[model samples]
Target: MDALNSGKFAGFNLSLLKFAWLSQSFGGVLFGFAIPMFAAFVANSIGGKLAFPAGFIGGLMSTQPTQVLNFDPASLHWVTTAPVPSTFIGALIISIVAGYLVKWMNQKIQLPDFLLAFKTTFLLPILSAIFVMLAMYYVITPFGGWINGGIRTLLTAAGEKGALMYAMGITAATAIDLGGPINKAAGFVAYSFITDHVLPVTARSIAIVIPPIGLGLATLLDRRLTGKRLFNAQLYPQGKTAMFLAFMGISEGAIPFALESPITAIPSYMVGAIVGSTFAVWLGAVQWFPESAIWAWPLVSHLGVYIAGILLGAVITALMVIFLRHMMYRWGKLLIESL
Candidate 1:
C-alpha cells in the first residue's frame, strides 16, 4: 500500500486508475442503465406522439428522428400504438446485455486502427440494436427499472444541499488522488450531475475551473518565491489548454497536469475548484445537465457572483500550488544533502 502511495509502480497505478474511471464513467450501472432509459424515452416519445401500434413502432423505433412522420399512420398500422410491457422490458434487457457484450468484445478483439473506426461507426450500433431488442424482451427490463428507480431516489434525496455536498466531496477527492481513480470518479459524478440536469451547469462549470487555475497559480507562485518552476515547461501549454477546457466544464482537462506533477498539481487544483464551485452554487446560478460552466456562464442569474467565484477559486489554488511546491522542493534538497 505504501509502495503504491509513493507511485513506485507508476504504470500499473495509471492503468488501474484508467480502468476504474472508465467503469465508473460508462461501464457501470449508471451508464449501462442510462442507455436503455434514454432509448426507452426516445422510443416512447416517438411512439406516443405518433400513436403508433406496438408492432409498427417497434420496427421504426430503431431509426433516428426524421421528417417522415408525414408517412400515413394507417399505412404503418403496426407502429401507430403504444408498445406492450414486453417492449419496455425488451429495451432494458437489450441495453444491459449489449453493454456487457460490447465491453467483452472490445477486450477480446483488437482490430487494426482502420477496422476499429469502421467497427465503431457501423458494426457497434447495429449490434447494440439487435442486442437491446433480444435481451429487453427476453430478460432484464424489470431489474433495470428497479435499479434505475433506486438510483434516482437516492439522488433526489441529495436535492440542492446534497448537490453542494457532493460537489465539495468530489473536489476534495480530486486533490487526494489527482489522476487516481477516486479523483476521476468524483469528477465523473459531478459531470454526470451536470449532464443529467441535476446540478446547474454553472455548478459543473465552477467545479472544473478550480483545479487548473489553482495548479497554474501554484506553478507561477512557486517560481515567484523560489525562482524555480514546479512543473516542466511542456506542462504549461497543457495546463493552459486544460484551464480553457475546464472553464468549458471538461474536468478531465486537469489529468495531464496532474500526471506530470501530482504533488503540487492535485491539491492546488482541487482546493481552487471546491472554493469556486461552492461559491457558484451559493450565488444561485442556473444549470441543467450537459451544459456546464461555459454554457451556463452566459445564462447564470447572478453573473457577477459567478464570475467572482471563478476568480477567487483560481487565485486561491494558484497560491496553494506555489506554497506546496516550495516546501516539497526545499525538503527534498535537504534530504538529498543529508543522505
Candidate 2:
C-alpha cells in the first residue's frame, strides 16, 4: 500500500512466495520447518524488546512434532501414531503473549540490582518457555486435534456412494487452504482411495489444476472484463507462474492470489474447483496417473472432456473473482464517501 501510494509497485516478496511454495516443492517443509522457524522468529522479535531470549526458546519449543502414520499389518488397519501439536499455531499466539509478558515484566518488575542479571537469562526465558509449552500442550494441541479430527470424520462419512458431494468435499478442502493442512488432509484421503482402487484420480486431478489456471485466467481477463487490473505489476509475473504450475499439477503457485484476497478469492477457487471436479467425474474422466495433468494426458480417459471440465471451472473462477473484487472496491468506496 505504501509503495502504491508512492506511485511505485511492490516487490514480489520472495520470502512470502518461498513460504507458500516450500511445502509443495519440498515435502513436509512448510509447517514442519519453515512455519515453525518463522513462528520462532516472530516470537523472538516481539519478545526480544526486553532483551529476553524468546526466539531461542520459542524456536525450540515451536518445533512441530512429526506426524507418523502406519498400517497395522496384523490388524489390517491404518494407525496414526503422531500426536497433533499446535506447535505451529501456538508459537504464533504465544509469541505475542510471551513477548508482551516479558516486556511487561521487564518494565514493571523491579528486582534487586544484584538479582537483575538473573531476570533475563534465568527468569524470563524459563518462565516464558514454561508458559508457552504448557499453553501449547493443553490448550492449542487439544483444540487442533478436535478440528482436524472433524475433517477426518467428514471424509470418512462422505464415502464413495455420495459421489457428487464427495468430490465437492475433496476439492473444497484443497481450495480452503491452498497447500496447508486442510489441503493435505484432503490429499491424504484421496490418496488412500486411489491406492485402494475405491476411486479414480479424476476428482483430485481436476481440483489440483483449477485454482492456478483459474486465477491465471482471471489476471489475463481482468482488465478487458472489468476495465481495471485485478493484479498489480508484481502479481502479473505470479499469474504467469500460476499458469505454468497448472500443467505441472501444483496448486501452491496460486497461494499468493488466495492469500491476497482470501475472503473473495478462496470461495471463487472452491466453487470453481468443485464444479470442475464434479463435472469431470460426471463426464466419466478416469485418471490413474495422478502425477502431472498435462503429462498424464495419455493416462486420462475421456481426455477432451477432462480438459473441458478444467477449462469450464477456470472460466467460472475468473469471472467470479473479478466480479467480487469490483463489488468489494465499490463497497469500500461508498463507505468512505458516506463517512
Candidate 3:
C-alpha cells in the first residue's frame, strides 16, 4: 500500500492523466465536435431532415456521414440520408488506444528536434486520426456494429423482464466496480438506445448519483450518532465533496469511503443504488441522455419522481451505513470486553 502511494506511482498517475487529457481534447475537437458539425453542414446543404441523425451518429463515431442522395420527382427535391454508423463504437476504442500508443511512442522513440516538432504538431495527430477513422469505417465498424446490436438486444430483453429486474441489473452493474468496464458497458447500451431516439427506462442514471450522495450522507449520520465533532469535521469536507461530485454524475467520488471500510460501505452503496434505481423505474422515469446529473433533471421525463428517487436512495444508504458501522463497533467492543 505504501509503495502504491509512493512518488513513483504518483508520477505515473500524473503522466497517465496528462495523456488522457490530451487524447480526449484532441479527440473531442476532431471527432466529437468538428466531424459532426461538418456532417450536419453537408446534410443541410443537400436539403433534407437528415442532418439530425447524421450529425448525431457522426459525432458519436467521430467520422463523416455516409450519405445517399436521391432526387424526388414529385416534390422536385434532393434528399440525403445517412444510416447510423456501424462503427460508432470504434471511435471510442481507437481514440483510447491511440492515446496510449502516442504516450508509449513518445517515451520510446527519439526524433530530431525539427522532426519531433513536426510530428507532434501535425504529422502524428493527422496520421493517427486518419488511420483510426479509416480503420473504423472499413474494418472495425462491421464487427463493432454486430456487438452493438447484441448489446442492444440484451438490454431490450432486460427491459421486458419488468422494471424490478431491469433496475436490479442496472444498479448492480453501476455499483459493481464504480466506473469500471461493467459500468461503462451498461452506459454504452444506454447511450445506444438514446442515439436511436429511444427513451431508455433505466435506473442507471439514478444509480450514478446514489453511491456518492449516499456515502456523503452516511458521514453526516455517523457524526450525529457519535457526537464526535472533531472527527466529523475532518470527514465533512470529503462528504461535501462527494455530494457535489454526485450532483455532477460521478460515482467514483464514493471510492475513498468504500476503500476505508469496504464491508460496510460497499454493500450500503450497492443497496442504495438498487433502491434508488428501482424507485426511479417504478415511477416511470425516463432518461434521454446517458449521462444523468442533477443539472439534467429537466431532461428526465418524470422530474419530481426522479428527484424523490435520488433523495430516498441517498437517505436509505446513509442509514444502512450508519447502522452497520454501529453494529460493527459494538461487536468489536464486546470482543475487547471478553479479552
Candidate 4:
C-alpha cells in the first residue's frame, strides 16, 4: 500500500516511462508497417499506383487505421475514405489511451499473483493494441484522411504552376530558419504529400541537405583559397560534423556558419538550397519518405538527377562563399592578415 501510494518500489515506479515505451513500439508496428502494408496490398489488387512505399508514407502521415473498406485505389482516393484530423492524431490517441489504461488498471485491479503476472505481461498489451486499432479505424482515421487530402490538393496546385516556383519557395523556407517554425511548416506540408505528390518532399529533402554540405565545402575552399587554416584545428572537425548532420537531414548544422557570417552565409545557403530543390523537382525526382536523409537517396525515383542537383548546389554555394570572402578581403572589409 505504501509503495503504491508513494510510487516507490526502491524508487518511484516510473510507470509513465514504461507505458510510453510500450505505446511507441506498438504504434510503430501498427502505423508504420502493418496498416501500410495492408493498404499496399489492397492498392495493388486494384491496379493503383499507390504502391507499398506510397502507402507506407500515407500511413506515416495519417498515423491511423483508416476505413479500409472505403479505399478505392483505382481512383487514387483519399478524402472519400474519411475526413482529416490533427497530425498524428491516431498515434497520439493510441499512445495516451493505452498508457493511461495500463496505469489505471495496474493501480486499481487486483488478482492472484500468477494471474496478475500474466495479465500484466500479455493480456494488457493485446487488449491495448486491439483498442487502439478499433479506435483509429472508427474515429481517428477519417479526420486524418481529410487533413491529408487538403494538403495534397494544395501541393498539387503548387506543382501544377511549375516545379521551379514551388521548389524555390520550399527551399527558401527551409533555409530561412534552418529548423525553426518556418522550416517545420514546410516540412509538415511536404511530408504529408510524400505519398500522393513526391515532388515537394523531394525538393525539401534536397534543400535540407544542401546548406550544411555547402557550408562544409565552403570551409575547405576558404582554407585553400587563402592558403591558411580557417580554424585553429588542423582538421576542422566542425565542418565534418556539419556534413554528417546534413546527410541526416538536419539543417541546424549550418546555424553556426550563418550566425558567424550572416550576410554571405545566409544568402549562399538559400541560393544553394533553391538550386538543388529546383533541379531535383525539374528532374522529377520523387521521395516516398519525408525526411530520410542522404542515406535514403537510393529510394529517390531519379537517383542520378538527385545526386547531380546536390552536387550542383554544393558547388555553387562554395563558390559563392569563396567569392564573397575574397571580395571582402580585397575591399579591406576583412581585416584578417592571413591572406
Candidate 5:
C-alpha cells in the first residue's frame, strides 16, 4: 500500500480510481443491477431450462444461474435456443453510453459541487438502466451477433498476420497516451478482442509496459551518455515513479517525461513504443486478459519473446533520449560557460 501511495504510483492509481468511479455513469452501476434483471427477463422470454452460467459479473451480483444464448450462424439469428451471458454486453454498452452522456452533460451544464455529484449519481444510474433495457432486447443481442460475424470475416480476410497487426496498432495507441481516453479505448478494445481470441492479452501487456520502461532506461542512460541532468534533480524520483507505474501498464508513467521535455521526450517515447509493439506482434505473443504488469509473467503464452520486445523498446527509447539529452546539455553548458 505504501508503494501505491508514493510518487507516480499514487497519482496513477488515484487517476484510475477516479476514472473507475466516474465510470459509474458509464454502466458500472447499471450492469450491476441489470444482469439479474436480464436473466429473469430472458428466462421469462423463452421458458425452458436455459442455463446462463454465472461468471465474474454474476459473481458480483450474487445471482442465480441464468440462460446463455446459442446463435444460429445459418440464419444469422440467435434462436434463443438457450439463455446467453449477455450481461457483459449489457454492461459495456451501458458504460459507453453512460460515459458519453456524462461527458456531454458535464460539458453542457455546470452546477454546484453537491448538485453535480447528485446529478451524476441519480441521472447516470437511471439512464444506464433504461439504456440496458433498450439494448438487450433490441441492440446488443444483434450487435454481438454482428461482431461475431465481423470477427469471422476478418479472420478469413486477414488470416493471422493482419489480425496481429490490428492488435499492434491498438497497442501503439495505448502507448501514445498511457491512461488517456485513446489509451483506454485501445486497451478496452484489445481486451474485448482477447475474449474472442482475436488478440492476446500479452500483446497489450507488452504495449503498456513499453512507455515507462523505455523512458526509464532513457533517463538512466542519459546519466552516463550525456551530462544532461534530466534525472539529476527532483526529476529523478519522477522518472523512477514512472518506471514503476509503467511496469504495471500505467501509461501516465510517461507524463512526467513529457512535462519535462515535451519537444523531445514525447517523440522518443513514441518511437520506442512503436518498436516494442511491432516486435510483440511479429513474435506472436498471445495473452488472455488485461492485468497489472506485475502479472506479466503469467499472462503471456511466450514470455521470453515478450520480455525481449519490452527490453528492445526500452533500449530504443533510452538511446533516443540519451542522444537528444546530450545535445541539449552540451548546448546549454556551452552557453552557460560562455556567459
Candidate 6:
C-alpha cells in the first residue's frame, strides 16, 4: 500500500494498485496477520529451513480476513472489501507457539532423507497453518478483543477533565519505551480518545517532548553539577540533537540516553513525563489536536501552563539523571544488582 502510494513501484505503472486492500485500515487494524507473522518467523528462523517457510505460509493462512464483493451504490461498481485485524500481537504469540511446535514435529517424525523436502514444505506448513487458523479464530481474536475493550474503557475513564491517573498512565507509557512498540500502542489509544472527543491530546503531547528535552538537559548540565559530562564525548553531539529534536516533538532523540543507561534514564523519563503531563492537565492545558511540535503550542489552551509544566518536568528529569549517575560509586563493581 505504501509502495503504491509512492507511485514508484516496479517499472510497470501499477497505478491501479492505489485501490489495494492493504491500503485500507479496517476497524483501525492495519494490514492483516501475514506481514507480522512472516517477520516474526524470519527472525525466529535463525537461518533454519523449516521454521521460516512454515512461518510464512502459516501466517498467511492464519487469519484470512473475510473479503466480500459488494456493490457500491454511489459508484455503481462492485468493490472488494475486507475487515483488517492488526493481529500483530497474535502473530507474535503464534510464531512462538508454532515455531516450537514445528521444531518438535521435525525432531519427532523421522523420515527417509529424500522425504525431508516434503516434510518441510508440505507437511509442516499445513499442520502449522491449521494450528495458526484455529488459534486466531478460537483464542487470539476473542481474548485480544476483550483486552482491547478494556483499554478503551480505560481511555474513556481518562477523558475530559483528563484525570491525573490518566495523565500519568499515558505519559509513563510514552516515556518509558522511548518510541518503542509500547509507546506507539499508548499513543494510538490516546489518539482514539482525542478523535472521540472524550479527551484532549494534552497528556501525550507533553510526554512526546519531555524525554528528549530532559535527557538533553542532563547532558549539558552534567559539567556544572558532576564536574564533567557523565556521558561519553560521542554523546555530546547526540545530546544537542536530542534538544533540537524536542522542539520538533520527536521522542526518539532520547533513545540514545535510554540505551546508554536504561536503569537510570528510563525511570527519569517516566517520572518527568508523568509530572509534566499531569501538571499541565491539572492546570487546564487542553489540546484537541494530536500535534506536539512547537508550532502546535499556540493552539493549546493555557499554553503558558503547558510550557511551565514542560520546564518543570525537564528540570526534574535532569536532576534525577544527574543524581542517579552520581550514586554509582563505581560503574560495574559497586552496583550489586547490576553485577
**TM of each candidate vs. truth:** 0.53, 0.53, 0.60, 0.55, 0.60, 0.60
Tens digit of per-residue lDDT, candidate 2, span 208-254: 89999998888889889977775656667798899899898788988
lDDT of 5: 0.59
Which RMSD values do the candidates have, in order? Answer: 17.4, 13.6, 15.6, 16.9, 13.3, 9.2
lDDT of 1 by residue, 1-339 (tens): 344466656677767866656754664445433323444444444433111122222222322111121345667643332222322333433433444555555466677887987766666555555655554433343444355445446757967777677557655765455445564445444544444454544554565567765665554565567776666666666667767776666666667767765766676777787888677776675555344556556657778887888788888877776677668767773121110
lDDT: the better of candidates 4 and 5: 4
- For model 1, the superposed segments whose C-alpha errors exceed 4 Å read 1-96, 99-131, 137-141, 169-198, 226-228, 236-253, 293-295, 333-339
lDDT of 5 by residue, 1-339 (tens): 333355555567777766755764555445345444444333323322211211222222222113346688999988654322333343344344434443454466667887877655665445434544454446555555466456647755887777666756766777777677677656555654554565566656777777788777775666566654454465566678888887666768778777767666777877787777678667766667457476657747777777788888888887887777667766773121110
Candidate 3 residue lDDT tens string, 141-174: 5556667667666756766454467678868888
Q: Which lDDT tens digits does candidate 6 get at residues 1-339?
A: 666667567554574454444334452364344355553555257425566654564345334433446899999999987533323444455666767877787788888999988977898778767766676656765564456456557766756543677788888888788778778757656764564466677888899899899989998897799785567666678888998999998889998888777888888878988888899899888888667869679789899999988988999999998788777634642232220
Cα lDDT over the full model 6: 0.71
What order do candidates take by lDDT, descending? 6, 2, 3, 4, 5, 1
Each prediction's whole-model lDDT (CA): 0.55, 0.70, 0.65, 0.64, 0.59, 0.71
Residue lDDT tens for model 4, 142-168 = 665566566556756876555567678
Candidate achieving the largest lDDT: 6
Please state the error at residue 89 of candidate 1 in Å: 16
Let me know the TM-score candidate 2 reaches against the reference structure. 0.53
lDDT of 2 at 217: 89
The 10-residue segment of model 2 with minimum total lDDT is: 330-339
Candidate 4 segments whose C-alpha is farther than 4 A from its true place = 1-81, 84-162, 195-200, 226-235, 335-339
Off by over 4 Å in 5: 1-132, 139-148, 230-232, 326-339
For model 2 the local lDDT of residue 107 reads 81
